[model samples]
Target chain A: MVTLGHFLLFSGLLMAVGLYGVLTRRNLIAVLMSVEILLNAAALAFASAAAFREPHLFAGQIFALFIIVVAAAELSIGFAILLNVYRTHGAVTDDAISEMRG
Target chain B: MSLTAFYALAAFTLVFAVFAVTTANMVRAAFSLAITFFLIAGLYLLLGSPALAAIQFMVNASAIPIMTLFIIMMTRSRSSGAPRTWQIAAGLLAAAAALVFFKGAVGHHDGQINPVSPELLGSNLLQAALLPFEVASVLLLLAMVGAIALARRRSG
Candidate 1:
């Protein structure tokens, strides 16, 4: 009974929430968290599409697995960047670290 | 019953995701994010992708949150002030626009819902996507090195 529309709607809402968070939050870590949410939304969409469209190939699930690994790598690097920024700037707010202002 | 369970899990994931994003407390937000991850994993299981669900549970639910917490501890940067009214308005507008866009873009799919088995996934990975899988591993290794290099204290 749960159709692709249901999954798409859920992921759409989640992606919207993540976009709002990314735009509004000043903290870099929070923005990173929002990015994670967005990635999860993408993964959900892929899985649902695979389930409905090409259920035999399992390509969508494999892609989702790759997405998870990439997200993990991205988080590690992002946290490292946060730590470095905190060490140098003494603050983590996106507005506070504006050294590269053109 | 299955449909009901799916709806419940989806609602739980979305609610906690909102909490993760909107809450000002950093630690609480991280925990909320973890809860969302777990709920999404459950949803994946309900969708008949147990391999993906287990990976989601292990990596997103447990490992990623722990890393985030460690970073939070190291930085000790917990001051999250309220956004300006204009920023909030812009964010809301963007969110609304995104919702409309996605809703219009994704069409309803009426094809057969064939659940992918773990064996199929493994064979596909090993046969069709083997190179990409190895490349992803290499990318992970590079990321590990890059993180270590970036976080290392400079020798004065």
Candidate 2:
């Protein structure tokens, strides 16, 4: 039986993995991917909680769906910003684009 | 807490979500994210929120991730070698947010306990308290518009 503890453990571990990716990855897209993972972990935890509790309060699931949609929207902006950074500099690395810092 | 199908599905959901979030390959992340979304829907089903589950499957798993993959494919081959200190700083900021929010999240349930109702999700958006869902849709639309606008070529 996967108790709530198990779910919490799994979610926590996944979140930590995501944290690693977010911290170390230098690629903007890769960083965004890590964020997505983190968000997914939160969603899973919320839905699981809904299942375990009164089985009546569905705000958790609704909130999760809301989160997913927001994540999608957030990603589009991130990708576009990455594209903008690339068009001007011809490189997406943060180090090379430092000339505009004056 | 036995190893029931619910547990199995939840485990799968989390695994795919990790795969999605941590994988360096963009296309693969998109694929795993789709699975993660579906698994979340499955969780909703087990919790008697069938309507929300179906929406998760359709909107999140099917629609959004596919769109992300399309964007990735379209943007592939672009030179994105890596980022520098400023970029690193941005990532650190996100990490900070994660750390700040995660610790006390366990006890921060802030909403009224609305009884789980499949019909609540099934009914027309205009009728129910669909404010959150509607706002989410609007946010996605805004993102789409903003991204397209940002990608527009700046006239010299």
The top-ranked prediction according to TM-score is: 1
Q: Which ten residues in a row have the lowest lDDT in candidate 2 chain A?
A: A1-10
DockQ of each: 0.71, 0.35
In angstroms, the error of model 2 at B131 is: 3.8
lDDT of 1: 0.88
Off by over 4 Å in 2: A55-57, A93-102, B10-24, B77-117, B122-130
Cα lDDT tens digits for candidate 1, A1-102: 777888888889999999999988888999999999999999998998888786655778888999999999999999999899998899899777997899
Best of the candidates, lDDT? 1
Best by DockQ: 1
Return the TM-score for each candidate structure.
Answer: 0.96, 0.71
Candidate 1 lDDT by residue in tens digits, B3-88: 79888999989899988889889999999999999999998887788889999999999999999888877889664667779889
- Tens digits of lDDT, candidate 2, A3-101: 454455556655765775677665566667677777767776776566566544355666676777777788789888878876766655446468879
Indicate the TM-score of model 2. 0.71
The local lDDT score (0 to 100) that residue B43 gets in candidate 2 is 61
Ten-residue region with minimum lDDT total, candidate 2 chain B = B106-115
